[model samples]
Target: MKQGTIHNKDRFLNKVADRLNRKRITEEVQLPTWSKQPQYEVFDGLSQDELLDQFVLQCDAIHTNVIVTEADKLNDDFDKVIQDMGGGSIVHWDDPRFESFGLDSALKKQQEQGTDVHCWNYQLGEANIKKAEQANIGITFSDMTLTESGTVVLFSDKGKGRSVSLLPQRYVAIIPKSTLVPRMTQAAEKIHEIAKEQGRMPSCINFISGPSNSADIELRLVVGVHGPVQATYIVVDDK
Candidate 1:
């Protein structure tokens, strides 16, 4: 990842340092020690399977479906999920993991069968958004998942449009077991580590839990007002 340059950054920093009556320090700052840390105590030292169980329970409360499958059967399971969701026009992020997980052939087969399948293309620009808006289902691999909130974190970029998740009628997240964490605290720490190792962070990070829900119109609950009406998570037991 390339670091983006900010114009007059040095001048702005120097002015801030002068106001603080100190020179600009370039050394890394140490994090503060919080005396009472309760966030980590929740679901502490749980096994991966235990975390996943908690995640599924939370998903049920939020009206999202969860499917568990093995790596060898992921292609079949994924295909079934799509078919169960009505198997119409589909849009997905242009990610290589689809090929690694043996879904490329499945998607290609769907295309051959006259099902409209669109992969987010950076070169196509707004054309990708238009396709996503008209798509019946949008699929993407979850970068990280928080068990406590049943939230899937998406690291969006050029080939991974946010519209693919927000504009579709239904949203599906493919969660590799290894990516599941206990809570958002762990997710934030992992993101911070990435920012430290790489020069730049992802362009967008979406924390989606379930289908869009609100109760603002006369206190009446509404689903799919702003985004997908249905959500599903396929958790693969992969290394």
Candidate 2:
């Protein structure tokens, strides 16, 4: 047994030595010169308007409801979404994009109407986390929307907690038309560029395609197992 172990050890070390001595390939890999880059080809024919339309359509197909509203009507639309979902406690990110539409006033109105609404605290204290976990709805400002996959990208950081999208029974994402990209690759590239410029990437970048779901146990379909069961995307025509 000792002899066999020694032989096997010798064989492993010899293989390691061979691998170490091998020349490393350093040739610059040329990316495919396809005009649409193969991956983004699906977005080639989609116009800006069509991109938004396709985003809504694809979102609907994935069991996610999409609502389109003009910039001026964003406050009304927010009320409509919360009302449609039966007005409940909500926890949302502290993004300036929402503030552009006077979110504070809208939130105050909702609170006055008996809806428990709170913004995520950048401090990330335990009490705030508990509050978010108990909330019925989670609202977030999407970094970008991918038309092809109906995905909403969210960069999590100090003021943006991943729990805001995961702990609640329902999720509401506010997406601006200007942030709509035709493909996921473009979205990823944008993130990469931001990281390069910012010197650091967000701790967690969530690409939510739809509500959390699984069909594993007994091959039975289930929703909200790990996150929100119902997801809504409010796409506003605001640059």
lDDT of 2 at 209: 86
Query: For every candidate structure, what is the RMSD over all alpha carbons to the true structure, in angstroms?
Result: 2.0, 8.2
> In angstroms, how far off is 163's CA in candidate 2?
0.8
Tens-place lDDT digits, model 2, residues 64-168 = 999899888889988889888877899988777667866677888988988888788967587668877899889998888889989999999888988899888
Model 2 ranges off by over 4 Å: 1-19, 22-36
Lowest lDDT block of 10, candidate 2: 1-10
Which residue segments of model 1 deviate by more than 4 Å? Answer: 5-8, 17-28
- Per-residue lDDT of 130-212 in model 1, one digit per residue for the tens? 99999999999999999999999999998899999999999999999999999999999999998888867899999999899
* The 10-residue segment with the lowest total lDDT in model 1: 1-10
TM-score of each: 0.92, 0.84
Which candidate achieves the best lDDT against the true structure? Answer: 1
Name the lDDT value of residue 68 in candidate 1: 94
